[model samples]
Target: MDQAREDWSPHSAHWGAFSARWNGATLDIRPYEEDPAPSSILQNFTTAMRHKARILRPMVRKAWLDRSARSERTFDQKFVACPWDEVLDLLANELSRIRTEYGAAAVYGGSYGWSSAGRFHHAQSQVHRFLNMAFGGYVRSVNSYSAGASAVILPHVLGGYEDVSRRNVTWDQVAEHTDTVLAFGGMALKNSDVASGGISRHIERDAMQKAARRGAVFYGIAPLRDDLPEEAGARWLPIRVGTDVALMLALAHTLLVENLWDSAFVARYCTGFDIFERYLLGRDDNTPKDAAWAAGITGIPAATIVDLARRLPRGRTLITVSHSLQRAQYGEQPVWMGAVLAAMLGQIGLPGGGYNYALGALGHTGRRFNAVPIPTLSQGKNGTSEFIPVARVADMLLNPGESFEYNGRSMRYPDIKLVYWAGGNPFHHHQDINRLRRAFNVPQTIVVHESAWTPMAKFADIVLPATMTLERDDIGAAGTDPRLIAMRRAMDPVGEARDDFDIFAALSRRLGVEQAFTEGRDTRQWLAHLYEPTRKALAEAGCDAPDFEEFWERGELALPSAPDDGGFLRAFRNDPLNNKLPTPSGKIEIYSKAIAGFGYDDCPPHPAWLPSTEPPDARRPLMLIANQPATRLHSQLDFGAYSQSKKIAGREPVRLNPVDAARRGIADGDIVRLFNDRGACLAAAAITDDVMPGVVQLSTGAWYDPEPGAAEHPLCVHGNPNVLTRDIGTSRIAQGCCGQVTVVECEKYTGALPAIHAFDPPEQD
Candidate 1:
């Protein structure tokens, strides 16, 4: 759709004409670089972005535009549309007031889906910078869009985000080098920011195929899909969703019992292997579960488990882990265990041997992990009171008397009275969406910055209209890719919206701390200051040919190189100390010394498996796995031409297996009520054999619309799944899964739905 149509001089654009195009109507297009963007002001932020330009090679033009465009956008004709001035003023005042009243800590930053093409000007950095500027300091976020599970798991596992994204393996080499590609989450193919980087893999895939034809084995361990081809012998393991940790435990037990583990590698590159092995053997009965036991639950034959476990690409085994497991109870554990499984295979520093979040995040910088020391922003940072690991949000909220130790101190829950949020819709996150609504009601003031009526926005005491990249400029620095691009404007403010950076920058100005946001010349000057570290690197290679200055003129900037890549790997191996992991032990923590101080010895130093949410009521049968659809990012698919594409053949329906359907007397296309003890939702059911017998699946992204009689709309539930499906208990306290595992039964709908149903018909013209 034409998002702009400004009357600029013909000479404005590098292209011949600035003639506007159209989606449904001609949008105002301008000479994108006129306005100066500013710093972001969300209390704390972790959002990640899309794009078109000469920066991309022509070999993938359409794919690049399709992948990157609309990293930032607006909800069309929904909610109250306001003029820019009113919107900006109201939005800014509300945010400023909220921060003053509640303190920056009360605010949460969020933006799950990716939006920008240029790596730097994307969500997390831009949003966080804005939030940090406005509120002094907001809670910092960790993890990338993909391996969020690993993010939570690895901090304790490999150490931190800097460690994981910093891995040296080019995982695509797996399909070519490994004899067996044991995988999980076949249901998820694309990485969260997969297409945004302009990396396509058909050519690479062909190479993988040639390697596969020469006798490579690929096993996709996930809930659905026999979709893997026969040539690759891609066997789909039917481990029930939320039960993955159990399966991993079983596999680990088998590997240990059969002595399939690489004992030599265990000693050389990893620590705590001896301790993990002892725990798995269950010298303690706390581990009531084992491989033979896991076999019964996972439904894969015990022999197959043994075979796959033993055959997992022995010297060159490539274990690919998925981020989805973290969406369930014990979310962090599985990814932890998955990484351990790879380490046990002894493949970390080897070619074609390692754990892949996916193929493309291979940082191209060719930078070394370090012969160099990391810079510390703080000297002796104390007094940032301890908190629970981020994955344990539910525990922080609902677990009675639950407390966690952080930074050498045990802390009780603070009486959080206010919530000031910018850049995120919590409805798409945390969990038990309905439960959260009531939880949110506890806050005295809820302030949010938004461009649309996001589910999280509905609960706000004040809604601020935030900019959509077009209204203001941003100097973004994405951690995912090694690029630092400028976000120049393409259109004027659509309505009351102003860029988040401007809102925060101006708010800081009002609060009498101009220097807080000041480096402090102007947005343009700030960009130059931010790029100071990379200038020499970019200059030396001529890769900075289109230097940031030139790139900024065109609404983008390219970086010189990444901090680590393939070459970095070989060089680091030659000198392990210079390339060693950034862990306390400076080696893979088959056993983390950090946890010994924390007192959770039962939890292995390496990845140890635990059961899914325990106390599973035998009466409540099937597992509910919330999966992502490629069509949309989180709950963001609404309000664009993209909306029309999400419908399966036109409309989406909750999918369940036929057997599970028959038991409940549910039929196809039936508007049935799906309810559990927590809450209820009425959705159309499409029973399919594609799903596991004991599992049901729903694709998230529908704009949550609440029932009409709802005393008040739960902005989080405008189609919010959480309203009816939230946790009564913080089951997956640390491993994630705050959203999955609700037991709901189906019933025919008796109530009337609005013109647009909570689950609407597939959007179309």
Candidate 2:
């Protein structure tokens, strides 16, 4: 399949590359033949383009249309359809008024860049560029909800986030030389189903199978049995939730007591090991972090811990940490301590042996880097500097002007009057859905560009219908993927829906900055401009560099990949002084002095075990694991056939251990209600021993459908785990999201079931 058929057009998605064709009745999708493992998420494309939930035209809330006051905002309001010209005029006027009355800082340009795989029509770049170049600067956000803790802490401890995680070790190296893989948080394949940009092929499953066939042992240190794929045949440890640091500390203590640690490597390649040694030996805490001490906390036997520690061969072990570990309270410690353990083993730079943060977390990781550059749309320079951590959206809206700390800087939340969001749904990603709903009610003007009737679109004062990926033509490229695809348009735009770029271009014209925003280029011309850099780089690298037209005709171009050897870490290990790390000490910091100067009690100078704030309460005994969903990407196209097929009784499934289910008299397919202090949600019970006792696994990404009521804590009928998750930060320093683990209690539902309207369109006036 060198080239797609005449009727089919090539395209790419976050999941993988595919060819699609419209036959007047159905849209046919064919996965790329090169992809060894295609994601079932591709099933979302069959009925998604013309789903009933698609937003047909520009809509304005009736209450906001009557009066643009915050008091007029409510979830029960009706939407009034208006012409594109009228809605654009209203949008331009509101933006101008907000900028003149308050400042450009009062406008928050929000986008998460997941709307499309096409670089030219990327919603984030379009919105940010329009705001920055046309409307002056706007307030922005920093960091993501997934790797917030590690993204802040890694630069201080080792290196940049990508350097340590994506570019450090290769899966090919693991298949060749690794002996033991200690997965702190089990590397589930579901987490690797989709990458941020587009991925041509998924290799985690094949790589893990190869490594297992080479006689490498894998240890899954999580409560779920299926966290590690079936091909790996990993032994499950089933540790207690949020107690990973205790077990890691015990491993280090055992290495110290038995003299198995590499002393020379620690002294030369690492800093502050002696200071950390005192704490490991109980000189400062007098508790002696031994196997027995960790056994009580993690529920693993002391003998098992000791034997596992002894089995790890120095210079032959790879320590992999999943993103799940650093998405909880005191999340930074587990990531930091995993690096410390790898440093102790003296395997930071060896082939197939080292610390790979978030190795199996996404599809793009653990793969070789591209030899040539990829296409990227340049977002013009921002105008304002005021920003907050991405997970602090609720706090920023609720407490404007309140001071907060992040990394090392202290800043205040901006007094935002207008929120322009595109490409993302905060209702799905943000914690405590009820709190986020209140935050959405605070702003004077809320505008959004949506393709479907998500909760974000329903809450917006103005909703502009945006086009789906299949309705637009652009170029698709990813940083790690080797394929550069020409995303040809497969279908016409539905109703009055427009591309985000065209929508922003229209607004730019209304604001009298169309020249600067558009650069005299339409969507097709912009795609060519964005692809030029990649073409030049490929030509320079001696690869085939076809022009945009030729490449478009060919459908896809193959990019060369770099060697599978270790990257910068290899050079740093080869020459410590010349190729030093980006950290302050130029070496791995087991104990960071700069962090100690912050004087935060929650996050100490070094990685230490901190008791969770939400301890075991008799009222809420079960620990809820709010993880990512396997059916679809975060609440996108939840009405599709693939996502809908996984539902039981028209609701998301919640996995509970047979032990916990029996105690509560729950059975498979039984509707159950999960309640905590924050909120409650109803889910279908799936009783199985795959999950451990006293734990329940309910995935996120269910469309947020709350029962209409005046109750402060309304029950979500769609089983959205974020409704019950707390909206607190991991600590003051990082301010990362700690919504992964929470305490909750579940009971079989005997009351009448509430109808779910999450996928339905809102009422139109």
Candidate 3:
């Protein structure tokens, strides 16, 4: 056994808190001692920081440098190394020109954060603040690609996302009180391995294990069997893909017909129940959403649906819907129906007996909030109101001035000429990589701040090298996480990379707004300033508020956590009249009239099961589940050793049922081609029964390695499911991304294999 190194420097990642030290040759990463089920994602940090994929210096696209037309912009263009000062000057001039000629609305400030756990160095905040202060604001994006559908639908039904998921029904409550957990989209532990802010402990497995030991039962209702943790001793109900709404409706209908639904609670605390009931009982449609009906659609036995419905009301039940459910066509239905089913059971406000959205989707959720304030970097308000949904970036870029409906509002996409992105990668998040590639060529200038030569950087006209988390100091804290980790500098900046703050501040100086952007503070000063709010709150609460210097030496601090009191939902359940929800009706909207007014045929007023748009065709019979990767966080460090270790033949692995694999003559370890109308990708086949027949599980976040000179739906050498995914929105109302599920077929690849060059740097001039 190795001795506990004394020189380990503490740091934080979205996965968990850890300490690292260079053991002469390689980095030694250790999880926080308190974490019971530490994540293997921390191993990625050991090799990713100084990987060859790291962007060494500022670069400009050769075509852009040669003054080629915007259509010539592409990922294959050579990147010419440019000095930071010269590139910054060029970017500053471009910003001024774009603002003067096309106005600030034409300059889209694109960033999705997730770059660092440190609040001050957060890419989204840094980019938005820089644009707001230095560039006089830019067109922004609303909602996230991950939870776009739920973020919009939750407010109209129950309340805000934070009110329902973050502050209500914590893991502690689930462990102690929950008897039955009906996970519509099974709470996969891999999905919960990360949190938006840093997470101190990985508690989901421990909590589920505790619940299972106490006679609690969990049912994983998804196409994949392992969505639930093994410790939960969960029963798997392999429902058909994209039919969660139908199953939920059947459960509700059983409750109604059997007289098990709490009519008194529904009448008192909920609105629009009668309207929804008519549809459920088939009063208007003459088709009752019964168990038999759902059995046909969901591929689950009718008896199982009735049994589950009966058992739900027998004990304290927690109905959970994962974020994956809402990343499909008409994605809003499953989310709305999950809340309605919980409402029917009338267990919504009880401890561990309510509706939790995306409960195990992230680490910070299903946990109590912090009792004190945490460090926050203020992103100044946008000067312009023109914006689009996060998933609609491709649409906005390609269809400028095209009107679209979102949440009952009609808005047009702004004509973006200059795109300034920092921190996050749009190429990894957006669906239909081929369509996104075309959209990327629309903008006159695309600038990015990146730490690696990711596909997004390759597609950009200007690439500014940025520092990785290990290279800089930051304060790591999440609202629900108790630990405040001092993310100390583990090493100097790799290559000529600069901190996002430094890069933005330098640009601000070039743009003559340095004072406003930096607030006359350096990185250390900003950290101290950001820490003051939390420290002052701690002092006022009579808690230990260590000075910045003392805190830095201590490495981490444990903050107080709020008791699980069920948040706003509990308050509303206790007193509906006084403590009401933020909805227009001020109660649970079982069938929202506001949504009905929108008149979207796809998304009706009630939670109706609309047939999926991406139906299985003869050519593409198998359904592809483009879900989150278990190895990495959305392609952030795909070149790292841990991620590389999981790759099959240097390409991402795709799991298929033995039945499907045999039909295609695709045996285990066989390199297969998965294709659809949109595009194609090669993946190594992993034959397993975990995935149901007619369904293949291919995780997203393989660096999109398209074959050279194959434009317009080119084949990706690396397994990137987004290449075959649809680019359409969920529906007219929410306009969320429908990237989760797509139809595709696979066959053994008989052609010569293309070398995997996704991790390699682009051609340099």
Name the better of 2 and 3 by lDDT: 3
lDDT (10s digit) by residue, model 3, range 1-765: 123335888999988899998654457898999998888988998778778898999999988877744346666778899998999999999888887898889999888889888888899999999999976778988888898999999999999988887888899988999999999889999999999778888999999999999999999989999999899999999988999999999999999999999898899988999898899999998999999999999899999999989998999999999999999999999999999999988999999998999899999789989999899999998889888998999999999999999999999999999999897777778899888988988999999999999998998989999998978999999999998999997777778999999999998998899999999999999999999999888888888899999999999988998878899999999999999999989999998899989988988888897998668889889999999999988888998889989989998999999999888888899999999889999999999999999999999999998898856778899999999899888998888999999999899999999998898898998
Name the TM-score of candidate 3: 0.98
lDDT of 2 by residue, 427-517 (tens): 8899998899888888899999999998889889999999999988988888788899999998888899999988988999988999999
* lDDT ranking, best first: 3, 2, 1
- RMSD of candidate 2 to true structure, Å: 2.2
User: Which pairs clash in model 3?
Assistant: none
* Model 3 Cα RMSD, 1 decimal: 2.0
Candidate 3 at 85: error in angstroms?
A: 1.2
Q: lDDT of all predictions, in order shown?
A: 0.50, 0.89, 0.90
Candidate 2 yields a Cα-based lDDT of 0.89
Give candidate 3 regions above 4 Å deviation.
1-6, 68-71
The digit string of per-residue lDDT tens for model 1 on 343-435 reads 777676566666654332222211223221111111112222323444344445444245654433465554454455655556665556555
Name the lDDT of candidate 3. Answer: 0.90
TM-score of each: 0.76, 0.98, 0.98
Error of 3 at 737 (Å): 0.7
